[model samples]
Target chain A: MKQLVIHPERCTGCMQCELACSFVQTGTFQPSVSVIKVHVFDEQASMAPYTCFQCEEAWCMTACPVNAITIDNVIGAKVVLSEVCVGCKLCTIACPFGTIFYNPESNKAFKCNLCGGDPACAHACPTAAIEYEDSETKDWVGPWAERLNESFLTALAGEPS
Target chain B: MIAGWVGKVLKVDLSARTHEVQELNLRWARDFIGGRGLGARYLYELLQDPTIDPLSPDNVLIFATGPLTGTNASCGARYMVVTKGALTNCITTSNSGGHFGPELKFAGYDLLIVAGRAASPVYLWLCDGEVELRDASGVWGKGVWDTDDMLREEVGVPDARIASIGQAGENLVRFAAVMNDKHRAAGRSGVGAVMGSKNLKAVVVKGSGSIPVADQASFLRSQWKKKASLRDSKGRQNFTQLGTSSTLMPINAIGALPTHNFLQTVFDGAEKISGERINDDYVVAHKACFACTIACGRVSKISDEAGGRFLLHTSPRNWKMAGEGPEYESMFGFGPEVGVDDPEAIIAAHWLCNDYGMDPISAGATIGAAFELSQEGVLNGTEGVLEWGDAGKMLQLLEDTAFRRGLGDEIAEGSKRMGEKFGRPGVAMVSKGQEFAAYDGRAMQGRGLSYATSNRGACHLKAEVLRADYKDPGHEGKAGQVARTENQISALDSSGLCLFLNSGATYDDYIAEFNSATGMDLSMDDFVTAGERIWNLERLFNLRAGITPADDTLPKRMLEDPIPTGPRKGMVSKLGEMLPEYYDLRGWPEGIPSQEKLAELGLEAIA
Candidate 1:
């Protein structure tokens, strides 16, 4: 099955993925509504896109009191139903990865659902940092990605990364 | 009636501490559209009083967002600051990219106009149509990054996007910029100096209000289709992989990259400071601004081994710690223009510009002028300190300029004034008091004309006729190309899309995005005309500001100096060959737009 894969080192943190995700899900171009969050760690000088890992235990689904969070059988992705969600944000706190977010605008917990298997983030990521591939996908890192990774891992002076 | 616009303006009189909500004239909006164009309309009207000084409280500062801004349209994170420039004393409309424009739109303003100076230093706090001038006493002296951080904490909104000036602005550095998201700046024509003159520290905005689209179905479809097209574009890929510094080598090869204060067109250290080198050595990761698919912004850190023993104690831990960019223009400024070969020095200089909030383009160009001045034995003892390729001295001067210290005081006046003071005005390569962008006019002939005729004074982005210029040299059919591109870019800049979007998308793409957003059926002809209208209006404003046909000529060097080396070795910018025809085509009789021409664009000629 195709799954969302993130190569954080290759991510430029442009947030195009987030903007694309927000537009696809919310019918509006708002980063706050995006399920995929690009965290820019400045001191380390890295950008990492974090989203639902589709945990084997499904902790968010188990933690939801209303059972609003459900796994899509077709995509193997967890999605929050806007109508069913009570905005209690139990799933937001329950997720170990902190991928699920409490959106105050909608008052619902939203996480990446892989856009029903066609993830917009992957489609929008120019560097291919975020991609949609088989769960057993091999690391087919592009030359540019390799170059970016080398630059990212290169230490300020001789300090070990 | 436009779906993408708020259709309202916030007018703040800082002197009175009062604000009034005013209905934006839709008639003007129809003609000017929005962003830079609409903002230009407002600034022109605001300055009807001839007595207002560009640096005086009477001179208004406007923040305007375009129709396509805050949309999912590719590269839509654009907003404009329209004011009389402290540097050029011309009507300057400087544009910036970041999250702030979108936040302002969400806060229920299509534009914000501040007139009259505050009694003391203050910041405009904006939240969902509510506006107030709050005392910024605590944050007055801080740099842009610290001010942004402190404002977020004080305003009690962690996500509020802030556009603030730093020590450079506070000190009235001629090329100081209003910086947003720390590194992204409206970095030209001294808009920040205007901000400083008013005692205005920052403008903070945040809101949850949604920007309604006229046609969601079509908008999404076009956005998706364009995103796919952008994904496959080679130009976008290059920008993604290498950042803007990628232009260095090729521009150098073309004999266009401004080097050693325009003394030479090529730099020997081109390879050392090229984008490829920056990518291999200094790059931490590629980065982006709001909604930009092309992550051309560089996230780089200064190497700990650079022996930059000098430190600014007043700065934050992350000041020299980390930063974004040293784009080709700024890189050209800090690298070749100033003769600094060390990539680490360029990185540190980039960080200093960000923290101090100065325009690297103007700052570097100024420093280059000083280097040239020192070489001529004008500032003899100081020549040793200000000599070319001295990155340490360059760094010190950058700080000094920000705070207006010692020799920094003279440098703060910018290249033109400094040159005049030192009796070497010819050494200063500037037009209308603003320095040239990285491209030497000698090689890029079209860019030279664009610089000479630029409404914002020697700015590259204003016209950006590089592609057409490179493809059609020998001054053949270059005027029409620049005129059309200028008009079209005016439209695009008004629409609030990134200029780089022109790489992957055509005018057709711009028309589609804007029409879909606003529920308008604007033809390509209408769109192009709207741009013309905007350009003419800006021309009228400049004419009123006393920029005559004489001001529309390039520097003496560009007109006389042939390239000493490279592909275009014998070439000098033949701006003289192009101007008469360009003026005729622009409908400017004797270089000022005629009454009949203004009427053709549906604009009332300025009295």
Candidate 2:
């Protein structure tokens, strides 16, 4: 299955992905409402655009009280049916990645639906930091998280990592 | 509500501790568009008495964003700070690109007009359209980097964008700058000094609003096309790969580096501080501003051996590992202009300018003027204190200038004042009390004209004549070209777009984006006409403020003293030859706009 992959090293923190994602989701250029977000580490001069990894476990789907979240057979991606959503943020709390967002204006949970197959973020990224390619579902953040952990430990120890 | 503009103007009177949200004037928005032009219009309206001191409470400070600001358009991240300049005593519009402008727009304000001085040091905090004037004592004396971190933590908004001044601004240095995003600067013409005079330390914004577009489909297509063109352009590739320092070697080769306070037109040590050197030795990563496809920002680190050099009494921050710049302008100012060749030293000074919130161009030029005065034995009791190529002294002077200590006090007054005090005014290579940029007038004749007639004193960004000047180093037909280019640039500056995009995109591209985003059916000619209107309005402001036709001139060195050595040796800027033609082209008799010209631009009522 095709999955969205992020190369954090390539991100320059321009927020173009967020701009595109928000336009697709909110019908206007609003980064605050974007499901995908770019986290900037100014001191370290680093940035990364992160979104839902689309894990096979589908924790948000399982955590939903109602059947508002359903899997699309064509794309095998979880989609939010806002019409049935009761404005409860149970799924937002249940997600480990914190990718799913609760929109106050719309009062609905919105996450990266991969644009049903061709994600707008992946397409909008100028540096190709975010890419959609066919692969088995894997933990994309594991390596980045480990590097960040190493840096933190190094700073604490007063030594270079 | 307008499609592109948020349609709200936030007016704050610090002295009265009051605030009001006024509707943005739709008529002014259509005429000036926004940013620099709109800001100028507002200033013209507010400051009816043009002779008021720039640092006085009467001088209003405006922070304006164009209609395209905060949008998904490529490089749509510019904002303008317009006020009477403390340095030049002329109407000044300083432009910057970062997340601040877009964030301001997202906060639903098209303009933030700051009038009256605060009773004490204060910072303005705008959170989703709500306003607060908080005590800034905690971060009042701090550097820009420290202030940025502290304010973000204090506001407790992780995503807040802050525009703040530092010690230089606090000390009222004539060329102090307003720095944002920690590294991006609305740098030039002493806007920060004005902010400092108002007792305003910083303006923090956290926005959660949307920018509605008039034609989403058309805007998207036009913006993408611009992005793709930039992606394919060699200029963008060079900027991304090497950053702006790429221009150093070429400018140096053209005999326009202006070394040793313009005593020489070229620097022999140019190769050592070139962009290739920085990229090969120091660059840690590349950076980009908000929505910018051309990631020209350089994030570099000091070498381990040289890291201990140029130490300051500041808390540890990014300078230990990585920081942005030594851009082309900074490299020129801190490197060849001051005669320092060490890339590490240039990087250190550049970083110091960013942290201290100072304009490196004027700062380094002021130091260069001092060096020349010392060399000429004009400055009293300066035996071993000042000299060319003294990197250690250069760094020390930068710190001293920021804090207004010793010789730094005189230097902080700017080169023009410093030279006059030392009884050698000719040593100051300045125009209209502001120091010149990197290029030497002798080698680039058209640039000479641009510098002489620049609305905000010696500025290079106001006009586009480099290609013509570089192609033919003569005083022929430059006046008409410069007048035309200035109008186009005025329009571009007001459009909330990066001028660096001119490397790949044209005015047509900008016009297309503007038309689609704002739903305005303006042709290329109409857009250029808007720019002409803005240019004339600025000229009127300057004339009223007592910057006469005589002020439209270069320094004595640029006009009379020929370059002593280099390819263009024995060449002088022919201002006398071009001024009349330029005035004629501008329809300004003796540099004063005629009544008919003002009427044509629909400014008869204002005039």
Candidate 3:
């Protein structure tokens, strides 16, 4: 499945992604409504674009007691159904990354749905800081996931078989 | 209004400690637009008596934002601070790019006009529609950064952005600057001195509201396309790599670097102090303003061993903070103009100006004038102190000038005043009272005309004739070129967009952006017409202040001293031939705008 990925070093802190996200969802220029956030560090030397990682376990989807959140198979994107949402904001708290947010205007939780397989944030990024690609094929993510799994197995083995 | 504009004006009177709200005049908005255009109109209205002192209680300061300021627009974070100039006797308007402009728009005001004078030092805090003047006695004497921090603490809003002046402004240095964001500045025409004179130290703003746009859907789509266009443009690459300092090598290559005051048009050691050198030597990171797609700002630091020794030797105050920059103008002002080729030394000088709140252009030009005068045996008792290319002495002089100590006191008054005191009135390379910026007009004829005819005195940004002149070095059609550029720049300034964007975008692009945000059906012709109107209005204001055709001419050195070398060798700016054509193109009869032109713009009553 395709997933949104970021190359933080390429980021210029322009916030074009945030503007694009806000415009697509909120119909206005609002940074608060943006699902993707660009945080500047080192006195603006480096910028890191952070967004929903769409984990395999899908913590937000499991935390949504109202069954308002679901992952689309085609894009591997966690989407919030506004119609079913009760504005409980449980998913916002459950998401460890804090990428899932409860937009005050919409009164519902929102996260990057990858724009039905084409994310606007990736499209709008001037420096290619954000990208959309197959998650398994991307070399960086594949190794990261494998390393995480290996660490989990090692911990389990050491616990005492 | 569907465009991203709040369409309101806020007026504050310091003496009465009262505030009022008024609708932005629609006709003015349509014709003059916002930012510099709005600032010009407000200044013209407030300063009817040209004889009024610039630092007097009656002098008004207008902080204005344009229609495109607070949108998802590329490089839209800009604003203009317009008032009577303390450095130059003429009208002054300085533009700055930062988040303050966008915040002001989000707070729902197009313009904020400050009139009268406070009894004591104070800072104005603005949040949404509310405004208040708070006592700032504690932070009054502090530098810009500390004052900003203290204000944020006092207001209990850590995110509140502040624009403040430093000791140079408090001491009434003629070229003191207003600094914001610890780095960006409204750094010309002594606007900070005016702020200090009024006993106003800072203005902090925190806005948490949206700027309503007329056609939200269209605006969003247009903004998206603009981001892509900007990303693909060549100008963005140049800016990303070399920043504004990119112009340094090219200008130097063309023999227009303005070395050793204006006595010579070329610097021999230009390569060492060029923009490429700065990037290779010191630049650690690139920066951007709020919501800007083009991150052209360079955040650089020089190593302690490289040029750090100069900082240690000169002033103990600015020891180890990462020095801000040697931007193109600062590089020229402190580098070639004064004959100093050390990049690290240039960086130190740049930091000194920022820390003490001095405009580097004015400070460097003033020192250059003093250097020239001392060389000619004109200055009083400067036998061993003055020497060309002496970085240590230059750094020492910069410190003195910032603190108004010793020789710095004389230089603090500016080049024009310094020359007058030394009994050589014409030696200062200045127009009106403000010193000329980095460009030398002998090689670039159009830039020469721009410097001469600039409203705020010898400012290149007001009217850029370099590109046109670059295409054709000869003075053919330069007048028309200067006039057209001046109009376009005026429009851009008023619109609160960085002029750098104009490299990739056209007037139509700006018009589309403006229309998208303001919901005003403004055309390219209408936008250009507004620029023309603003240019003429500024000219009229200067005329009323007693500036004449004579003031619209270059210094004798630029016209008489031929460029000694380079491609355009043995050339001088033919201002005598160009001025008449420039005046005619501007629709001014014999260097002064006709009463009919003023009447057409509703400025006839003031005339």
The candidate maximizing DockQ is: 2
Q: Say which candidate scores most in TM-score.
A: 2
Clashing pairs in 3: B2-B213, B2-B214, B3-B213, B3-B214, B3-B517, B3-B518, B4-B517
Chain A TM-scores, all candidates? 0.79, 0.85, 0.82
Which window of ten consecutive residues has the lowest lDDT sum in model 1 chain B? B307-316
Q: Distance (Å) between predicted and true CA of B48, model 1? A: 1.6
- How far does residue B331 in candidate 3 sit from its true spot (Å)? 0.5
lDDT of 1 at B541: 82
TM-score, candidate 1, first chain: 0.79
B1-607: candidate 2 lDDT, tens digit per residue:
4578988999999989999999999889899988999999999999999899999999999999999998988889999999999999999999998899999999989999999999999999998868999999999999999999999999999899999999999999999999999899989999999999999999999998999999989999998888889889988898789877888888888787899899998899999999999999988888888988888888988875565677743522557857899798889888888899999989888999999999999999998888888778766653365778998888888888999887889999999999889888888888888899999987998899999999999998999988898778888999889999999999989989988988787777898899999988899899889999999999989988989989988888998888998888899999899989999998998788999999999999998
- Measured against the true structure, the TM-scores of the candidates, in listed sequence, are 0.91, 0.97, 0.91
* Best candidate (score: lDDT): 2
Sorted on DockQ, best first, the list reads 2, 1, 3
* Model 2 CA lDDT for position A45: 83
**Model 1 Cα displacement at A93 (Å)?**
5.1
Write the residue-wise lDDT of candidate 1 on B1-607 in tens digits: 8788877899999999999998878877777889999999998888886335788989999999998888767788899999989899888889999789988887888899999999999999999867889999999989988888889999998778899999999999999999998889999989999999999999999875667778988877787778777778888888888877888998887777888999898888989888999888777777777777877788776655563443544553475556787788878989999888888788778877888889999999998888888777788644274767888888888888999887788889899899999888998898888999988887887888888899888988877668766665577677887898899889989988889886676777678778888898899999989999989888888888887889987778889878788777878888888888899899887898878888888886553
lDDT (C-alpha, whole model) for all candidates: 0.83, 0.89, 0.80
The parts of candidate 2 lying over 4 Å away from their true place are A136-161, B313-317, B381-383
lDDT tens string, model 1, A1-161?
78777888788666778778877876666666777888866556677887876866778999999989887888788888889999998887788888888878778887888888888889888778898988563223345477767875675545655
Give the chain B TM-score achieved by candidate 2: 0.98
Candidate 3 Cα errors over 4 Å, as ranges:
A42-44, A55-67, A88-96, A102-111, A137-161, B153-158, B217-221, B224-229, B306-308, B312-323, B381-384, B600-602
Residues A1-161, candidate 3: write the lDDT tens digits: 66687887678677778877877776766665678888755343567888887777778989999999987866667789999998999998898889888868779888888778888889877777788876555235567568769988998989855
